[model samples]
Target: MPNAIPTTELYLIAMAIIFCVPYLIWRLGRTDYFAPLVVVQIVTGILLGPGVLGAIFPDYYQFVFTKDVIQSLNGLAWWAVMLFVWLAGIELDLGEAWKQRRESAVTAGMALGMPLVFGSLAALALIQFPGWIGEKAQSWQFVLGIGMAAAVTALPILVLLMEKMDILRTPLGQRILRYASLDDIAIWAVLAVVVMDWARLERQAIFIAAFVPACFLFRRFMTRLPERDRWYIALIWLAVVSFGADWCGLHYMVGAFLAGVVMDHHWFDRDKLDTLRHNVLLVMMPVFFLSTGLRTSWEVGGAVVFLAAGFLLAMQILGKQAGVHLAGRLLGWKRGEASVIGWLLQTKALIEIIFATVLLDKGIITSATFTALLLMALASTMLTVPIVTPKLQRMRELISRDA
Candidate 1:
């Protein structure tokens, strides 16, 4: 199958094109207008999706928007996210992460707390939406997932943007880094609690139980071992990890993420995992993101849909603004600093979008509600493209001057 072309190969090719087109837009727009690339990517997805282009090609749109294809790609996309999230843990310079712990916690609490409340309520209100809305999203679990995702921030995206603007090394940038890192970790832990399947949860517990002591033991063992054979042991664990999270309620990637954190000490060896993560991120991240676009269908209809959509936007703006504002006040940070940090966390992402899709597929939510939530998420993320530039410029001036 790897080498053979299926009848549906064209759809796959189209999907691939959709994926890269956004990145190109991002690159091209990087210096031109405000977050032009981000805007283009999301708009491109909407255009290619049933929302726009899907209307033009309803029949073929089936292949493009099929449950299986979009779902599988979403899976792959989230897997890439897992690797990236895992890599985040491994790359953590803990000393630096720890230095700003106080502000990190303050900011994280602001970002994480408010949105969680807003999203959960949004999810609940969606059920009351009483329309062709996604019924699957009406549940406590599904609602919780939506809230958690909304309440959370996209660490990888934020980090990438901060680096691009050269804010990461600055004090405010540093605060964002610390705060975003903590937020990322919180996201993982929340996912684990809400979504881990039975098998996955079991393994997760074992990994958690053994992690600290095992790290200590591995540290000692590795120091004493002849350098020649460490690769063999590492290879075995890699295989174990590939299937590890899969057995859990989570994906193999989640297991892979935990594997990364557990094996963080292997950072010195670097070659094996870093190379794998780089490959995964480069090849699959965009694909995963594109898949998100494809799965989005405007066909979902209902009064609740509009309500959910409006609520999502409101929560995103209000939640971030409130969270960051509070965190800033708590820390005596400037209004601009808190506002920027708040915006950073509330942004939506492909992984959480896909994860919500997963819940929808499992019949965990009603279709209308699921579609509504998807619409909300897509809108929130797409809006970020427009909002980011103004937020970043103001933050840079305030933070740079503060420094």
Candidate 2:
């Protein structure tokens, strides 16, 4: 035992690997043009996962990701992701979407609806094969779950990319946020449906019934608290609600999003909120990314997974483009505007991964299906900046357009 490397040391080594590998590749390779640091981190995670690194270097993988070390990493990953999801919910700008109700409704509806339909069709085809569907999943659950994953837009990553491109505060940026905000709500609601446990129906009903009053009370209490106290109290609310949701078999993430959605973003200073998000991504999210990557598998064969990913990617891209273009025509949008919106709206990186994780956790999809969804997400996100940059360059006026 004296010759043993302590679990603490192993954990630190794992953390070091988690942060260093992605950072160096991103910095040295200058991949920010096509792949941002976040995307690189995600890809690095897949490389470090059991399917890749473990397959190549089983001893090293086992040493660094021993059960104890993985548990520690997973603990951090859960909390980090909860905070990230909470922030996304807090930043939802429903008021703006309402103000532009007619246009936002038409655009957000088509943007979300089309991919959903197409992706559902893809899912139906996927379920025709063995090893793609989860053991406990119903046919409907698997299809809807996969469909929803395809339609997801990673709002946080979208914000980061837009900020990097210097369009975050522009009129065009706000318009896109409005559309994404509406779609975000729909995505989670659909997830709640997909994960619903009939056996826990009573518990779920009770949770919802109590949550309404609790949300009202929490909002009232939050308004009276000082900003510093509000921050601390918000974390408490996040833990309580997330626990309650999980206890009711609805999943903790559903609670986390609800926790943030009820709380007003105006309670915290915008600058500080932005800083917290950046800090969380800087210090904690890589762990989440790494843990997520660890869940990837190729039990169904690597070729099959990639082909599935390719099919899902094509469906996602085509569906999103068709939806946005249809809306653009109906709304009388300027030429090329729908193309920019379509490509941007299709960036699925984090949220899609999160959705797939939920589906996998709930036994609605197999690990192979999860791997395919993850690849589809990475490809969609990486395509965003590269494709959108030139379009924006050509249509410089689109950046300033309010509608």
TM-score of each: 0.76, 0.98
User: Candidate 2's residue-wise lDDT over 30-139, tens digit each?
Assistant: 99999999999999999999999999999889878999999999999999999999999999989889999999999999999999999999999999899999998999
lDDT per residue, candidate 1, 130-229, as tens digits? 5433443235667677777577565555665566656667877677767766776777677666665554566767766755576577656756665566
**By summed lDDT, which 10 consecutive residues of candidate 2 come out lowest?**
394-403
lDDT of 2 at 254: 89
Candidate 2 residue 43 C-alpha distance from true site, Å: 0.7
* C-alpha lDDT values of all predictions: 0.62, 0.93
Once fitted onto the true fold, the runs of candidate 1 whose alpha carbons sit more than 4 angstroms away are 1-12, 19-52, 62-79, 130-138, 198-239, 265-281, 302-307, 354-358, 361-363, 366-378, 381-403
- Clash totals in order: 15, 0
The list of candidate 2 runs beyond 4 A from truth reads 1-3, 397-403
